[model samples]
Target chain A: MTEHPGADVVIEAQNLDLTFETNDGPVHALKDVSLTIDKGEFVSFIGPSGCGKTTFLRCIAALEQPTGGSLSVNGMTPDEARRNRAYGYVFQAAGLYPWRTIARNIKLPLEIMGYSRSEQEERVNNVLQLVDLEGFGGKYPWQLSGGMQQRASIARALAFDADILLMDEPFGALDEIVRDHLNEQLLALWARTEKTIGFVTHSIPEAVYLSTKIVVMSPRPGRITDVIDSPLPKERPLDIRDTPEFIEVAHRVREGLRAGHSE
Target chain B: MKQVLAVLTVVAVIIAFWYAASVPMNIRGVLVEAERAGEVVDPPKAADRRQIDEFELILDNPFAIDDTWEQERPRLPAPHQVAEELWDTTVEKKITSKRSLVYHAWVTLSATLLGFAFGTGLGILLAVGIVHSKVMDMSVMPWAIVSQTIPIIALAPMIIVVLYSVGVQGIIPKAVISAYLSFFPVVVGMVKGLRSPDMMQLDLLRTYGASKAQGFWKLRLPASMPYLFASLKIGIAASLVGAIVGELPTGAVAGLGARLLAGSYYGQTVQIWSALFGAAILAACLVGLLGLIERAVLKRMGMA
Candidate 1:
């Protein structure tokens, strides 16, 4: 393991292991999983179910405790980083509090983080605009379409302006067309914000298209099988999926998944 | 329009059933009165009249059936008799008068509302404690359950006696009993309500590094609204029962329960039925009011 010269590492995990003790027996959710995510990088963890992809993301957000390993965010413990408001996490579901309107839901983190009334408003408006949900702020989550609800949730995560954004299949529940549109919007938001994003996804195309680096993982003692640095340029159009480089990366990820399952 | 018609249809059926039942129930008393009035009596002797069935007497004397529904101090008062008593006591009598059903109802309602307030407050507090602390969950929840197992009828007298010894008479003792009955449902329902937030929602709050208090106010509290309203409806009904029961042991001079006791002592079946109806109507109004508020609050919160 070597660091890229002058690259600012945002997250580092070494020999990470988490075994959940159940009635059946000990389930090894993650075993000796090691990865590093750097600043301004779009890193996607792609794998089948129970592959520790979401588990690893949860570990970064300090929502899970690693049993036997060192994991750090910006050189601080994940818990400390969490306390310092270092990252914003988006769940698979939109999870916008149905009782709150879009604007209020976005302001929830700001309110929790002790942002001033004026600043909360401003940030909520800015993120709503960024997610292309500017006018729908006052509408309740149920009033919005599924895609729009998810965008509102994204706006919520972005409102606090954390340096790291951890998303666990944020668009997994949406239709392909809606997913594609959200993907494009997400990329535009990432480029503008320059936030290091850690995305978990099951779709190889989604991983290959949006991520700067794709970490392919395997299940049953979950660990990384392959790490592919995408050769596609930062500015990706939906048509870029047709490119040879995109196909090549997708092929490698598929191979890694197959190889893991064969073990 | 359809709902109103459905309710009216049900009420009409019940009233018709009541009117029919009144004939058989009051026939004996009506026959005895008919004999006293020197009407054509079967067997022409009081001792022989007792041997024959009231239905047989009614068959022999068809004219006596009309008087059955208007009997004074009959075994089962007719629906109209109870309704007339209710109207006379509530509308004809002054509210301040001891004979007024409104005065008695106000007495019972005050204790019910007071007890409900105390019960709801204590229940919510206990639920918060039970939800937040493992010690309370383990230690207090079982005791709360045990408290409910004790028959309130048996407990009501003891509660009154204990309160009287301490110079705490009047509404407080009754309110305490009401609170006792109402708090259990709230504790159980609220524990469930407070714990209703899913792992994802809780984890979302954790990711923001939210404190327990913040999580409670922003997440758990609002999420529990529907459950809270559900528990409150049950709690209020229980409170009303508690208030009535509490009145019984205390020998309360003014309350629906007291009216029932007095009516039974005097064999005034109409008065007892009217008091029972009053309590039922009051409970319905209270529960209905809670349902309305639940709708309004949940609608405002966008959960309705």
Candidate 2:
């Protein structure tokens, strides 16, 4: 996650700050945070619950306004980028509209973008196959397992083929086995799509395994405590978790998280 | 099937109670009328003029049960009399006849449907306003609540009078009252339904850069279907009641309410009971239609 001199910058944050004014007082959620994500880079933000990892991701997606400083997505304001459909966001929960079938849920963005009916169908089928949920298009989200539902949510985000993916705790709710399986599948998906990813999670192993860059953040006046450039290679297998290099990256992420908590 | 059986059992028990209660309620009237008709006009002979309590006369009468069921001006009509009256008016009489229950029910039904449509549209519009704007939520919602506090019974006459003065007569005034009674439930239910999507869901839509109109059509409106149908059920029943109440103050001799008024004036308890049953049946049919539509729509939407 060292800055690649020639790599195109997809997302940039410069002295970004977001403070929420509560009834008690002003709660500084993000203070003077700055980061740059290059094209095709998978960046993971790891920290405690109150840390502004999710907040920062939301700010990038234009779901939340930064109280101060400048943040840009695709060299434009977040709001403008959002309007341009620069990114696909996968939330912590599947957040599928229960009223719609899996195929219809995937087609939602395409429908909003006013794609042709045939194009929407083709994209839905493609994304469903991409997520390994081809036949599940007709089924409802409740009929699927939690892992499958999350995958469907991912498919929904991938439906319109955006350049960037912002995933907030997409696999945090899954058990370890499903998490591992999904992690491998996610890496494969990322390699195939080559989209810039901004992932938020609390698990050190997940961050270490999936990310080229890991951002460790602190709570209270939420700030970035450490930004580790992972030295592990890009082609990660499920068994790589047992290797020494993977363990070393995970240890660094853990130490960084601990340092954030201690501050 | 089990729910139907339970409902049928309750209906049977109620009919049994109604039959039993009608005997007591109609007996005093029957006894007085019979005594007047059979007034011992001829002076009783010494053997027949025994001292007895006033209750002893009714107790001694063997045909009191038959008389109670057949009284022309009964205080409370027997169940069979009410049933016969309903069947005769609804089936034997022509549907277009003024005396027919079907004709009167249609009159009331038209008003109920018109008012229900108006209320539902108004409620949805207001709910959208309340959800999207702080000003409407703070200002209009309180007034909507306060509007319900004024009893429909007290307000119906004034609404009729005011409408009559402005040359708005008959169905319009009744429909207005029906709308007044029905709108509150729709507003409350729809406001809740429009806001039903959780923070994650809203944020997900925002991340997609969905406009307010798009968000409403895709998320809010579909999400509110169940709540809207539930409110419509309540609202339809209220609308029917409003229509009947609307008929009462206007002195119209057409709808079921007019039947009730005429029955009361002429002391025809059976007619009054028939009109009441007619109104009840109309409300049930309206609500049942809504339920069917709800099931079809919700199932089609994959929510059921």
- Clashes per model (N, Cα, C within 3 A): 0, 0
Question: Model 2, B68-185: lDDT tens per residue?
Answer: 7777877878778888999999999999999999999999989988998898889989999999999999999999999999999899999989998999987899999999989999
Top lDDT model: 1
**Model 1 Cα lDDT, one tens digit per residue, B2-99:** 99999999999999998878887887788788878988777678788788877787787778778988888988888888889989999999999999
| DockQ for each model | 0.88, 0.78
What TM-score would candidate 1 get against the native? 0.97
Chain A TM per prediction? 0.98, 0.97
**Candidate 2's residue-wise lDDT over A1-263, tens digit each?**
23657889999998999999999999999999989889999999999999999999999999899999999899999999989999999988998999999999999989888899999999999999898998999998889999999999999999989999999999989999999999999999999999999999988889989999999998988899889888889998777889998898888878887887776
Q: Residue B148 CA error for candidate 2 (Å)?
A: 1.7
Off by over 4 Å in 1: none
lDDT of 1 at B156: 96
lDDT of 2: 0.89
List model 2's recovered fraction of native interface contacts, to 2 decimals: 0.88
Identify the leading candidate in terms of TM-score: 1
RMSD of 1: 1.4
